[model samples]
Every structure is written in C-alpha cells, then in structure tokens.
Target: MVQKYQSPVRVYKFPFEMVMAAYEKRFPTCPLIPVFLGSEVLSESASADGSTHVIERSCKLSVDAPRLLKKIAGVECVFFIQKNTLSWRDRTLLIEAHNETFASRVTVLETCSYSVHPDNESWTCFEQCASLDIKSFFGFENTVEKIAMKQYTANIKRGKEVIEYYLSELMSEGITEIPRWVPPAERSSPSKAASPPAAPSSEMPAAALAHQSPRLQMVSWGPDKLDADYIERYLGRLTPMQESCLIQLRGWLQETHKVKIPKDEHILRFLRARDFHIEKAKEMLCQSLTWRKQFQVDYILETWKPPSGLEEYYAGGWHHHDREGRPLYVLRLGQMDTKGLVKALGEEALLRQVLSINEEGQKRCEENTKIFGRPITSWTCLVDLEGLNMRHLWRPGVKALLRIIEVVEANYPETLGRLLIVRAPRVFPVLWTLVSPFINENTRQKFLVYSGNNYQGSGGLIDYIDKEIIPDFLGGDCLCQVPEGGQVPKSYYLTEELENLDHIRLWAETIYQSAQVSKGAPHEIMIEIVESSSVITWDFDILKGDMVFNIFHSKRTPQAVKREVSSSVPAVNNEQLIDRSWVLGVDYSIVESPLTCREGESIQGSHITRWPGIYILQWRACGPTHARVDEVLSSLQGSAPKCKVMYYTEVLASHDFRGSMTSLESCHSRFSQISVTTTSSSQSQDGSLISR
Candidate 1:
C-alpha cells in the first residue's frame, strides 16, 4: 500500500520576498538540517528579466535508519534529485523532489511550494504533499513504511523551524527584505545604470541559469477556501497529520461531490469520529454526505416548521450561552409527553424536529465560534427530568427516541459538547437503560447527571452554566422562554391513516427487521453473550396481536441459525446459533420477568446479563400454553396459531467494545442488527439499563 501526506496551507508572518531569501539560505549546505549533507547543481535557469529562476540539483542525505537496514541496503546515504522553480515576479517558490536511491524497490515523491498568501500580500503561504510507495522491500515493508512516515512528519515540523531560523539569521544580518525582480525597462534609470554585483565564487555557472520554464500559476483552492488562519480560528488546532486528513478529505469531496462540501467544522467531526484515520474518516464522511443529499437535509432547517402543538408543548428550546459560550439548549424531557408527541405527529415528524435541532445547533456553533473568538463547534444541553415516570416509558416512544439518537449520533458526531441532566428522577435509570447503548461513549462521558438538590451544590449546573441564566424551574433568576412541557391530549393524535403514511418514512431511516410469532412457535432471537454483566436491550411493538416477552440464558447452545448480517451495520456475520435442547432452570434460566404486551402497544426494556452464555430473546403469543415444547408442538398440527411482532435487540458490553463503531452490524424493527463481540476491557462497561 502507498502512503500519502498533505499539509494544510501554513502562513508565515513575513513577505514572500523575505521568506524566499530565507528559504534560499538553507540550500547547498545548512547546518540547521543536519541530514541535508549537500547538493550539487545539476541544472539551473532564469527568465530573461530575472523574474524566474529554476535550479535542479542532485542532493545527498544521510539515511536515519537502523544499522541492520543500512547494511542490507548497502548504503549510509541516500540520493535524491531536487528541482526548484523560483518566480520573483509572482513571489512563489515551487520545489519538487524524488529519491534516486533504492529506486527499483521504493519510490518517494514530494512537492512543496511557498507563495504569497492570496488574501494577504505581506504574508507567505506554504503547502507540502508527499507519497511513499514500497514495491518490493524484502520482509520489511511495514517497518520501512512506519519509519518513513515518522521521518517525513519529523522533517515537516523541522522544515518550519528551519525557515524561521534562516529568517532570524537574515534579520540579524540586516537583510530583512529583498527587492522584487522587475523588468529592466520598468526599473528606475539610476538603479538600471548601477554596476551589477559580482557573483559569489560558489555560485552556479550562469549558463546553467539560462533555460526558462513556464510561468508557475498558483492553483486556486476549492470553493470552501480553507487557510491556516481559518482552520486554526474555526476548526480548532489539529495536528499536522489531522490537518492533512481534513484537507485531503475536503478536496476529495470537492472533486466528487457536486453539492456544497460540508464546512470544516462538520468535516472535523467525522475526522474526530474516526480518530483521525484519513481513509476511515473519509468513508464515514462520504456516507453522511450521501445521506444528507439523499434526504435533502441541507434544506431541512429552512423547509421545516414546528406545528403549534409542538411549539406550545415541546419542552426544548435554545437558551442562553453556557459558561464556555457553547449554545445552550434546554430540554425538560421528563415533564414532556414523548408518547403524546409521537402519537400526534408520528415518528417522522419528531425525527425531522430532531434533525432541525441539530441543524440549528450547527449554526449556533458557528455563530458562537465568532462571538467567543474560539472554536465552539458543539452545544451544551440541559435536560431537566424532574417528573419522569412510567408514563414516559411508552415503548413506541422509547423506540422513537432510540431511533432519533441513532440518527443523530451517526450524522452528528461530537456535536453535544456536554449534557447536564438535573433533577433526574428515579425513572431516569429506566430511560437511560433503553437509550444509552445507542449513545457514543465519548458523549456519554460528557454526561453530568444530577439528582434532586445535587445540582444546586458546588459540582452541579453552576459549574457549567451561570446561575443567573438557569431556568426559573431550577430556582434561578432567568425567565426561560422554553415551553413548560405537558402531556399532549390523545384527541390531538393523527388518524391511523396518517400515521401509516408517516411510518413509511420512519421505516427507511431505521435498520430493523420484522417477524411474526405464532402461539405454538415463538420467535426467538439467539444471542451469544460472551461477557457477563453486559446489557441486552430490546425494543418491540405488538403490531397485530398480544405477545409475552421473556429473556433466557442457557448453558446448552441452541440450534445454529444462520445470522443474516445487514449491510448498514458493518460487523455482523453468518455465525452459528446456540444449540437447542436447553431445558429451563436445568440448562437455561429466565433472566427477566415475562412481560405481556397488548396488541397495538410498544415495549422497550433491557436486562443485565449475569452469565456468559447463549441468551434467547423470545416473543410468544400471549395466551395459555402447554408446559413443555413437546406439548406445544404436538398441538400445532391441529390448529394454526396467529400472532405478530416487530422488534429490535442490541447486546451492549459494559466496557468499550474496541472497534465496535467501525465493525458492528445492526438492524431495526423485529430482528436487531446488533453484532456484539466479546473482545474488550471489562472496566469500561456500563451494565445497567434505565428509562425515563
């Protein structure tokens, strides 16, 4: 595999002419760059008016590598051919280099440029890109690549300091600036008539500087013009490699995507999500971009409008700034009727509302970045869950919330800077249990949950938000305009016909599967739980009939049912299911109490798995049944049992599931697309489930 690097445009607070003079001082022999032994001029050229000068040299550099590798390569030094084109008229210097040593086994190409900043004439901009390809390194390709990249990154860092060193040296010598080259005819008469300075004894032959290359036109960057200053000011400070990833990904999007590329802040989120792995981040970003375009999400904020019902009853709105100037959003979730809202507007409307909030949040982040004179790319949310209870734990509503959380987490990584859950009630645990698996661990770490008067003390909301800006309900002075969340009347719910129409939209956004369970034949999902204390979560709706939901753990594996891995969820595979013949209590035991869900009711809950074994999630028709499977199977031949359900299940580890974000496969509705693996640290796991 070939490796590549591209640096963001770096700005120097000096004129291009002055910078170029500093740059020239490093050539031939510079003690500042010890590895750069020396260079022999292969060729040199200049424009007729002396506005352009081109020099080609064969450079020799000491190889910074292990003695064993050096002995194998049979060389202590490496040779490279460098080409430098200096355009005095345009105030630009372009350098291209390629290695000559080990040409048959490896190839390295680098390009560097120093030019006048487009928007500022007094400053210079520098950009660098390089690629290393090892075609046939004998048994050391990976080691060689790692060493090469480390060296390249180190050199890049030193390159800046080297230029600064030369710049300072020139300033000390009173050669702070050099006059820009001009045509002879344009020069003043006295200057033109002045005697020409004698060339240095070490200067290259004049004949070598006779040839001319074409004028070097600076390639304009894309529509989303990003510069060093802009990146630092708005996108925060990224490491050199991270900056390269952002630039490369943005350039790829600009080339392939016709629509407006996401802003730097948006791109940075995806980059951070993938931990600055350029290719991985690019893959994720492309998917998100496609999703945005497919859904016309760019126009969501402009096209979406809240219904009067939501405007009056929804418990969330933008409040004042947080202590860090993050746009503050207050959500009184416990007091709000999530079930009522879902019934009235259906899942689709609520989803759109959530997306709109995210969009507004991004805009607010940008506004605050300027207002605070720093990067503020995400918002802080204050969730007051004082009145949360069983009523809020409506199954379908919880499912809707999980679906929304999934969508937001996927498309809006790193958007929630902090979460302040104050006045958290006992029922909050139930709600958290159902939803926390879908939340990123990074985001979860930002959660500051406060119960009762715990938030009024020293380590509470005041630490994050100013006391004066706290909402009135929280016993603060501010009169928050956010609605006082209340239950929406059942009468306001849309007709069943309207809800069905909205379900189509909701279905497309989720990764759930549906299955029908008959009385004699229960639909059982077999999950191989390899980690004790992990949480098994489920969300299901009794679409056509009543059903009983039960969770069981069996020492005996069930029959191997081929697991159908879905594409959207990456990590699933066709693994063998646990074997059958597992007797209750003897080989298997019920871990959760059986809950009978009525027809048209939605259910969401989770269980803490106590043992590492095959766990079965079974949904059966809610009615009288035989005591044994043989008795139930024996009666199935005479009559057909009817029942149906749609459910989704997820196996969440108590600790962080290493590579789970990149590898896990998931689905929605009946069969969950969760593909949990058992390879992770136990200390990072959160085993409990909660709902509010």
Candidate 2:
C-alpha cells in the first residue's frame, strides 16, 4: 500500500520574498533539524531578467532506523534529489524532491510550494504533499515504510519551527525585509542588480515586529484550505498527521459534495471519533450526512418546536456551563415518567424531542466556545435518578429509548464530553443493561456514575461542575429549573389505533427511499420527463451487496407495479417498474453506461436527457454474467444474494439544471447514444429481468 500525506497551509506573516530568503537558509545545513546533514548544489540557472531562478541539489540525510534493519539494508545515509523552481514574477516557489537510494524498490516523492496568501498580500502560505510507495524491501517492507513515514512526519512538524527560527535570526540581525526582484531595465543602481535581492532593514517598530509572528493573527484562506493557526484556535491542537487526515477528508467532501458540507468543527469531530483513520471516518461522516439530509436534521433547530406536553414533561433541558466551559445539561430521568411520555406522545414524538435536545446542545456548544474563548466542541450531561422505579422498565418505553440512542450514537459521535449520573438507584443498572449495548464504546467511556449522596462528596460532581452552578436537585445551593416530571394522566394516553398511525406517519417523513434487490429482482423507479434537455439527477448509497445502476428511457409508459410492503421492514420499497416482457432496444433504451456500485459507497450523478420520455432508474443485484442454468436454479434454491439501496432522485428543467446540479455534475457522466450497440449483452441473459 502506498502512503500519502498532505499538510495544511502554514502561514508566515511575512512577504513572499522574505519567506523565500529564510527557506534558502535551510539548504547548506541547519542544526535545528539534525537529520538534515547537508546539501550540494548540482546545477543553477537564472533568466536574463533575473525574475526566474532554478536550482537542483543532492541532499544527504541520516536514516533513523533499527540497527538490525539498517545492517540488512547496508546503508547509513539516504540521498535525495531536490529541484527548486523559483518564479519571482509570479511570487511562487515550487520544490520537488525524490529519493535516490533504493529507487527501484522504494519510491518517495515530495512536493512543496510557497506563495502569497490569497487574502493577505504580505503573508506567505506554505503547503506540502508527499507519497511513499514501497514495492519490495528485502522482506522488511512494512518496517521500512513505517520508519520512513515516521521520520517524514517528524520532519514536517519541524519545518515551520525551522522557518520561524530563521525568520527570528533575520529579525535579530536587523534585516526585516527583502527587496522584490525587478526587471533589468527598471533597475537604475548597481546595488539593485543582484539576481536574488539582498535583505534590507525596514526599521520596523517593535509593536509592528511583534505582529510578524504567525500565531499573532488567524488567516482565512476560505473553505478550500485550512490554516494551521485557525485549526489550533478553533478545533484544538492536532498532530501533523491528524491535520493531514482532516485536510484530505475535507478536500474530498468539498470535491464530492459541493454544497451543504458540514462545518470544519463538525468534520473534525468525526475524524477524532475514528482515531484519524481517513477512510473509516469518511464512511461514517458520509452516512451521517446522508441521514441528516434525509431527515432534514440540519434545519431541525429552527423547524422543531417542542409540544407543550413535552416541554413540561420531557425532564431534560440545558443548564449552565461546566468547569471546562462545555455546555451543561440536566436530565431528571428519575422524576420524569418515561412510560407516560411514550404513551402520551408516541415513540416518534419522543424521538423528535430527544433529537431537538441534541441539536440544541450543539448550538449551545458553538455559543459557549465563543464565550469561553476556546474549542468547546462537546457538552456535559448530568442525569439525576433519585425517583427511579420498575415502572420505567416498560418494554415499549425502553424500545423507544434504544432507538433514540442508536440515532444519536450514529449521528452525534464525540459530541458528549462527559455524562455524569448521580443518585443512581438499583434499577439504574437494569436500565443501563438494557441500553448500554447500543451505545458506542467511545461514548461509554465518558460515563461517570455516583450512587446516592456520593455525588456531593469531594471527588464527585464538584470536580467537573462549579459549586455555584450545580443544580439544587443534586444537593447544590443553586436552584434547578429543569422539569420535575411526574406520572402523566391516563386521559392523555394516545389510543392504540391513533398511536400506530402517528408512528407510521413520522417514520415515513424522510425524503430518501430504500429498496431491496435480490437475484433476478431489480428495484427501479420511473420519472416522466416531458421536456428534452432536462437533467435527471440521482443520489444513492449501496447499503449491502454489490449492484449495478443504470438509466433507461422509453417513449411508452411501463405498467405500474404495486409496492410489496414487507411487515418486517416497512421502510423498504420492493417495487419493479420495468416490465419483464419489454425488450431492451425495442421498448426501452439505455441512456447512460451501467455503473457497478459497491457496499458503503455513496454515488451521485446526473444525466442530461436528449429526448423527452419516461426515464427509469434501475438497481439490479450484481452476479456472474455467464453462470449455467442449473447453477442459477441451485443458487435460487439456496440463499440468493441481496443488495439494499437508499436513493433520492430529482428532475430539473433546462433553465434550472445548471444552477441546481453542481454537486452531481462531477460524478459519472458517460452519456451513451441511444443506439443498439450501446446495450450490454448481459441484459438479455437469464436472471436479468425482474423475477415474478
């Protein structure tokens, strides 16, 4: 496997010319970076006008590796060829380097650039990216890759420090600026004729000089890139590698999801939750994004208004801040009647109430971060269980709680800094036992439990909460305003029929629809397009086995098929719109090339319609193209392969297509002509049509 690393933009509060001068200081030898022994210039050149310079050097570095592995490799030092291209006219420097030792077995390539910051002309921005590919290393490929990457990351971290050191040295020597290069014709004096302009003192004031530090100001390079100072200030301290993963993931989302991408703080939470594993975090984040869009969770804060009954009986509300500035929430679970809420409002309303709390918690976190002047990404929750009993263990109520927990765990990972449980009764463990399995292990670690009066002791809630702000119900002097829930009246209980109807209504509120695809059974939907040149856009996620997605168009409408509603999985829509008797070219024609989607992959693409007709989007289970008839029959008798897809489709008229289809335009756009040759041979094979 090849390893790639990308560094966030590190800004230096100096002009590009001054930054270039400091960077040149690291070429010969720098004690700051001990591994950087020295470099010898191989070639040098300059343009006639002295506005462009190019240099190639051979650099020597000591390899910090295990002695045993070093002996096996028989090398004490590694050599790299560095090529520098400086364009004074454009105010940019591009550095490219590659390893010369064991080039055939192990390949390492690095690229670095320094340019003026987009928003600030006086500031310089530095960015780097590198890749390490080790094919064969004498049976020590893994060890070699690990050592090389470790050393590389260590060097990356030191790069800013080294530049800052040189910048300080120049400042101490009273050289605060370097004159920019000029054309030969424009220079009048002999002193200004040098190819690389000499450093000159601007006699800058002490206060002005103090502002030159990179940490003094936060630079905004817009959404395309993250500034190192901005990351530290808003997202907390992250190692160089973690920053790389965040930058890479954020860039991928920006490229794939052009609009409605989550905030940087939100993306970083997912990265931290996955331990900086880029691929795993990307998958988790994508799923959450899909869920948020499906339910419009992003707008829940503004759209959700708690019912008056829930307002008085929910037993959960935001309190003051914790010691570390995290927003504190108090949930009087013991006093609240869970069964009453479930009976009165149904599971869906209860879920909506819980979700609104989470949304409110996140909003408060952002507000407190500004108030506290720190990175406050998560909140604290204090649960008081003084009035606990066996009535709270009702099965339907517990079931509703579990569903809420699942939704929060999947969508709100790493958003709970601490969970303080006080006055825990014996039945608390029973409740925990029923729901603990559904909670994530990372979240479970944040639980801090105290039984009975232990919460008022020295090593209890006081350690995390301020004495002045602790709720009075928890034995503190402060008065608690959270609702003291009681048993709801039986008159408020919802009738069984009304409760079932409300549950289904709330469950079907999502915009995305899911379907199951089995062998010889393809799930498809049809869109009637009356105007030519309109755009058909679709976004879908493969939740299970592999499947092929294709777009087809036909002038005649296919017979409508009734949706087979499964009792076990009511959310799944098992309906096929393409008729089995229809021929491929005779009845319908494939518009776009078939795309095979794998499990856990999110696909968004659009096709511009050439002619007006009914367009069918089909998702068929993927299988062998040339299986024998007996094999197919045997497979049907056994467990057939199944695939699940969650999808949403939209049609934009020609006038609105360009403005609305930005996110899907970059996706697969291989538009094939509606000709017989474009049809796939596999479409005519057995098991290709929807099974009756």
- After TM-score superposition, the amount by which residue 31's alpha carbon in candidate 1 deviates from its true location, in angstroms, is 5.1
Candidate 2 per-residue lDDT, tens place, 1-692, comes to 54667778899999998787787676556677676666777888888777787878777777678888879989877777877788888898887777778777766666777899999999999887766667677897766666665656656767788788888888898989777777778788887564565321111011110110111111122258888998888889988888888888887776556555789889998998899998889889988987887787888888878777888888888888999999999999999889989888889988888888888888898888888888899999999888999999999989988999999888888999999999999998899999999998999999999997988868999999999988877768888888888888888889989888877877678878887776666777889988766767677777778888877887678775544334543444655666666778888877765777767666765666667779888888885422333443344344676688888888877577455333333332332122333223222211111100
lDDT of 1 by residue, 78-149 (tens): 777778777777777778777677777776776777888888898999887666667766677777766766
Q: Candidate 2: give the clashing pairs.
A: none
Report how far off residue 561 is in candidate 2 (Å).
6.8
RMSD of each: 20.2, 8.1
Worst 10 residues of 1 by lDDT: 205-214
> Candidate 2: lDDT of 305?
81
Which ranges in model 2 have alpha carbons more than 4 Å from their true place? 189-195, 198-223, 500-502, 517-522, 529-551, 560-586, 589-613, 619-643, 650-692
The TM-score, computed over Cα atoms with residue i paired to residue i, of candidate 1 is 0.66
Superposition error at 548 for model 2 (Å)? 6.1
Give the total clashing residue pairs for model 2: 0
